[model samples]
Target chain A: MMSWLGETWAILSKEWRCELRSRYALSTVLLFAITTLIAVSISVGPAGATPEQRPLMPVLLWLILLFAATAGLPRTFVHEEETHTADPLRLAARPSCLFCGKTLYNLTLLLVLEAVVTPLFLVLLQVEVADLWSFAIALLVGGVGLAVGSTLIAAMVAQARARGPLFAVLAFPILLPLLKLVIDASFVAVAGEAQSPALGLAVLYDSMVTVASLMLFPVVWNP
Target chain B: MTIKQKTFRWLLFVWLAATIWAAFFYAPLSQGFAGKMGDAPQSSRIVFFHVPLAVASFFAFLVAAAWSGVYLWKRRSIDDHRAVAAIEVGMLYCVLATVTGAVWSKVQWGAYWNWDPRQSSIVLALLYYGAYLSLRGAVEDSEVRARLSAVYAVLGFVVAPFLFFILPRMASFSLHPTPGSAEMDREIGLVVVAAIAGFTALFCWIASLRRRVLDLNAEAG
Candidate 1:
């Protein structure tokens, strides 16, 4: 178990090094998030949501992050295949370790994305949080769930012909429930704490999907 | 066409014919709610077919996922074929469910499209299976296609509950009924069960035929 964790760490560090060197995925994802944010903020303008629209900000925030994820996260797996590094990596790393490392990497990237876009959303879109604690936990847990899901899907889609949009098509249905939970969590956070189970539910969803991803990863990663 | 199989086919046709008859003529008119022709007996009749189509499609997806899990374990091309067959047959039923549910929604809720949780969940199921088909189309090798889609089907198994169960229930504002079985009249409930059984059998028949076609195609190739 210790060795497995160590191997996972190794893969994650390698991912960081490669990612930093290329700056390919992070840049694309961040730019997409920022671009979407800017366009949306420009549309919504100085005035935030109308008084009747209670859940608009959280909905918009999560949608931006979700779209940005689709724009970039698949690159984590697709790049390995494109670089012809997949075969060596396949032989060298255990499937579970590789999946864990890549998921952690993707989680980091998603967090980076959430960090950059979220504050901009707050300032530019003027999204107010009534409960900061739930908001943070929701974002973290949701990001973790999306990261794990995208990692498995990335591996699946990596082997296919149409790599890019196909990733979103496959990822959307699977990620949507988790997305809803997080959105609700964010809503409750903004709606002033109604004691929502959305956060707990998101945690449960993340654990379930994470376990399923781990069990299914070897089949996806292997030929 | 063995004698037994032929008889079974004819029986299915007659059984379905009987279900239609019972749904329309035999079953009591459902007490409709407040609306124009919400008093209409036909309003309740949609339940017979609508419930069955949704139930069958859900079963179809379950079978697909089950076959997919088996395929991953056994590495049999046939299991993959079964999974695909179940998905295709289930997709048709799922679409029918969505459409029928929509028409009923218009009658009852006064909207063809409400983005109701039920509607959203079914559309997502369509997309989920549609993505499965697309993923299969994208892969060149049969072995790899079977492998990856099987994994995906299993992952979908993980997601299906959230789509079918969690999303709609959270809305709590859904106009759809919750296990109306208890409140359902005996005759209507019986016909609904009959319809569900009929549709499920039809699903199996269609799926088996699809599997056979794949087997033949594989053999020819």
Candidate 2:
């Protein structure tokens, strides 16, 4: 078990090293995120927006995060296939180990994105959270759900003909339920409602997707 | 077709015919406001067909997921054929259910698309299976397609309960009736049961026929 985890860690570090050198995924995702945030902030200009628009901030934030994650996460596997490194990687690591490594990398990338985007969103949208703990939990759990979902979907579509559109099309439906929960949790956190059941649902969604992705990744990875 | 298969198909056809007759002729109109629509409650008749299609779609997904699991475990081409066949038929039923439900909603609620939880969830389900089909089409290799789609089918199936059942219930307000809230009269209930049974048989027959056609095409190729 220790060796298995070590192998996964090695693969994760290797991915990070490659990413650091290229900075392709990170830059693309961050650029897209910042652009969307600015556009939204300008269009909905923090001060002039009506009261009805307050509830929509969470939805907008999630949508930006979701699209940004979709833009970036597929590179985890697609990069390997694109550079013809997939074969060597497949040979070197067990399918499960590779999945673990990719999933961990995706999760880390998403957390980093949230760290940057969430504060900016609050500032730009002038959104307030009554319960900071609940809001943070929502972002954390929701980020995990998004990462797990997109990582598995990225692996599935990595070898497909239309990998780009296919990734979003496939990931959106899978992520809808989790997104709904997270959005609701965010709404509640903003509304000052004693942290609602949405947080529990988000946690449940995260665990379920994480487990399902782990179990199903071997088949997608090998094929 | 074998004699047994032919007989089964005939029986399914007859059962479906009877269900249609009973649904229109025998099932009592829904009570209250639904029964009062257009002075004759003709719109309520949609339920006899609509609810059964939804139920059958659910069953069809279960069939697809089951066959997918078998295919993954055994790697049989026939199981893959059956799995995709069930999804195709289920997609048809799901679309019909959505259209019929929309019609019913327009008549009952004065709007066709209410973004009701049930309505949204069905759309989500359609997209989920639609993605599966797209995935199948996108992959060129036959074995790889079968394997990957099977995995997707299994994973999608595991998620279905949460998508269809749990999430919809979490919505605090919806126009659709919640379970245990709407009471069906005995006659309508019986007709609905018959319609469900007929639709199940029809789904099975169509899926089997689809599998045979797939096998024939494979052989020819």
TM-score of each: 0.97, 0.97
Per-residue lDDT of model 1, residues B85-168, tens digit only: 999999999999999999888878788999888889999999998999999999999999999999999999998888898878
**Model 2 bad stretches (over 4 Å):** A46-49, B32-40
TM-score, cand. 1? 0.97
> List-wise, what DockQ does each model earn?
0.89, 0.74
lDDT of each: 0.90, 0.88
Considering the true interface contacts (CA pairs under 8 Å between chains A and B), give the fraction that model 2 also has.
0.62
Question: Which ten-residue region of model 1 chain A has the weakest summed lDDT?
Answer: A45-54
- Model 1: per-residue lDDT, tens digit, A1-223? 9999999999999999988998989999999999999999889867876666656888889999999999889998998999899999999999999999999999999999999889888888666788888888889999999999999999999999999989999999999999999999889888787897788888989999999999999988887
> How far is A56's C-alpha from truth in model 1 (Å)?
0.7
TM-score of 2: 0.97
